[model samples]
Target: MVLPSVLNADFGDLGGELQRLTDAGARALHLDVMDGHFVPNLTFGMPIVEGLRRHTDLPLDVHLMISDPLRYAGPMVDAGADMLTFHVEAVDDPAAAAQSIADLGVAVGVAINPDASMDQLEPCLDHVDMVLIMSVQAGFGGQAFNPIALERLRSLRNQYPDLLLEADGGIKASNIADVRAAGCDCFVVGSAILKSDDYGKAIDELNDQIASANPSGANISPGQEATR
Candidate 1:
């Protein structure tokens, strides 16, 4: 499904922005948590997630781009995160990390950068509920779309038919069709929805593309949402 990334949303008016996305048919929200050490950027922490949890019912898909995801996983989950994703590049034992996160009673997710491969995630595939495939370099927004992500998503789908695969970065209506056709179960969109003049219209247009792209006409029907 379409997961509107909060990284591009107005920090001054996030509640209203979230309400607008919900009304626009977005089923979930993607929160990018970056630590300077891991991604050369630092964003808000649990307080923001706590505040957002009080403001909306939409599931919070928290992506932790931190050096130590295991350190922050529990706190994020306690802050009302429904799905938690961490970079494989950050930890040595993916299975142990995934198990720990899964034990917290939320959907466990694993993410890989554009340069990373599906083989890197094989160790934690069965432990994770979803997988986030970064199309652009992590730590920034508004980068150009990368087609290599489509190939990766397709590769993941081939290996695990039912695994929930997500694609983040540089995604928009123009290329969403190809992304969906490549087997992305969730699309983490930033500026395309946040920068639009009309949130509802932009989301509707994306849904239309997702609908028409797949011959099976399946919705982004995953057990949870995903992130950057």
Candidate 2:
């Protein structure tokens, strides 16, 4: 599934921007909530999520790049977050954090930075519904796709075949195929879609690439071949 991040969207017309993505066939919206302390950048919060909820019915996958997600998770959930992902490096206890978020009745997820390994997530994987692997350093947008993420994704796929693995940051049509082939089922894209001249066409191009890249054709069935 393609989830266009709101961080790069036009703030002047936020609602229209979100609607455009939905019209472009994006199934979900990636809301990056950053606290200045945790990520060196401040971004959207519950009020923004609340406003976005009134604009679109798309599921909000809220990525909390904050130091204290335990304090904000419930508020985000109440603000209409369908899924919440917190960084493993942000909290003291991943398992407890997962349970706390899960207790709020929303899908829980764990995110790891490019330098982190699967071992960091071992304690919380059981409670998470999805895993977000940062393809670039967190807290920034429009960075280049890191090749190392592909290797890590492959290892995760090998160990957890059915887990919903997501690749976030620096994802575009150029690398979506490689990421999908590396075992990512979900994509968290930002500028590629938001910065495009045509939202729907950009999304279609990404979908086509993902579908064609599937070797087994189990996940996506496309008419054209995915170009490397």
Candidate 3:
């Protein structure tokens, strides 16, 4: 599934931007909630996520790159986050955090940074619905894609075989196939889609590409190809 990260969307016209993406066939919305202390920047909070919830029917894939994620997990779920992800580096008890988020009836996810290993997520894989592998450092958009992460995704695929592996950071139409082949099923694209002059066209092209790559049309594999 292709989720367009709202971090790069135009805040001045959030509703319009969201609607455009939704209309363009985006299945999910990726919300990056950051705290300056955890990552070097700060982004949307619970209220904003709640507001976005009312604008679209698509599932909200919330990535919380903040400290004390356990403290904020409940509120984010209550505010309508369908799937919540917290950095593995941000919490001490990642399993507990995943459980807390799951308790709210929302899917749980764990994000591993560029420098973090897939081994760090091994203990908590069963508790999460997905594992987000960052292709670049957190807190910024439009950064270069780290090719090393591809190897990590391949490793995760070989190990888990059933976990949903998502890739975020520097994902665009041009490199979607490379990442897909490397074991990424869900893609979180930021500036690539939101910053484009032809947002709708770009999204269409991406979806078409994804479909072309996986003709079997099965749901996306945990780390391999996306099921059509």
Candidate 4:
């Protein structure tokens, strides 16, 4: 599913932006919450979340890139975040942290950086609802998608048939097919959708692109790792 990231959206006109996305066939919205320490950046807090809750009916797929995910999970969920994805690098016991957040009546997702190994992320797979493999470093948006992410996704998909895999960073109409082919069920799109001339049309094009990609396996053709 194409989950448009708020990080790249027009905050000045978020209401209209949300409406446009909903009309463009978006099933959910990806909200990136960054703390200055954990991600070297700062973004939406609970106040923003509370405000965002009233604007859309689409499920809020909140990604917490913070130093203290467990401490803030409840507040974010309480502010109407439907699903919370916390970075594994921030916590000591990822598995336990995942369950602790899950207990807040929301589906838990765990995110891993591009440099993280597959085995390091596997321990939390059984406990979380989804796994978000960051295609770029976790701090900011609009960075290039790392080719290593495809290998990580491929390895994870090959090993866990039931797990839901997601990919974020530098994904757009061009390389989306490759990412999908690499076994990402959820696509967290940012500027790819936001910066387009026609947001709805761009989203439609992306969805169509994803629909056309082979879903059976990571039949990655030689040198298919896209630069975009």
- lDDT (0 to 1) per candidate: 0.87, 0.84, 0.82, 0.83
lDDT tens digits by residue: candidate 2, 14-115: 978877887888777889999999898898799999999988887888999999999988889889988889999998899999999889888888999998
What is the C-alpha lDDT profile of model 3 across 1-228, one tens digit per residue?
Answer: 788899999999998998888777777889999999999998889998999988777788889999888889889977888888899998788887788777887777899898876667867887888889999999999899998778888988888787788899888878877777777779999888998888788887777676676654225422222221
Q: Roughly what TM-score does model 2 have, to 2 decimal places?
A: 0.93
Q: What is candidate 2's local distance difference test score?
A: 0.84
Taking all chains together, the TM-score of candidate 3 against the true structure is 0.92
Worst 10 residues of 3 by lDDT: 219-228
Candidate 3 vs candidate 4, TM-score winner: 3
**For model 2, what is the error of residue 104's alpha carbon versus the real structure, in angstroms, after optimal superposition?**
0.4
Q: Which rank order by lDDT, best down to worst?
A: 1, 2, 4, 3
Candidates 1 and 4, the one with greater lDDT: 1
Candidate number with the higher TM-score (2 or 4): 2
Best by TM-score: 1
2 or 4, greater by lDDT:
2
Error of 4 at 96 (Å): 0.5
Residue-wise C-alpha lDDT for candidate 4, range 52-137, written one tens digit per residue: 78887777889999999999998998999888899988888999999898788888889999876666676788888888999999
TM-scores across all candidates? 0.94, 0.93, 0.92, 0.92
Worst 10 residues of 1 by lDDT: 219-228
Name the TM-score of candidate 4: 0.92
Local accuracy of candidate 1 as per-residue lDDT tens digits, 1-228: 888999999989987887788888888889999989899888889999999999888788899999999998889988999988999999999999999998888888899998876688989998888888999989999999888898888998998998888899999999999999999888999999999999889988888898889755445433332222
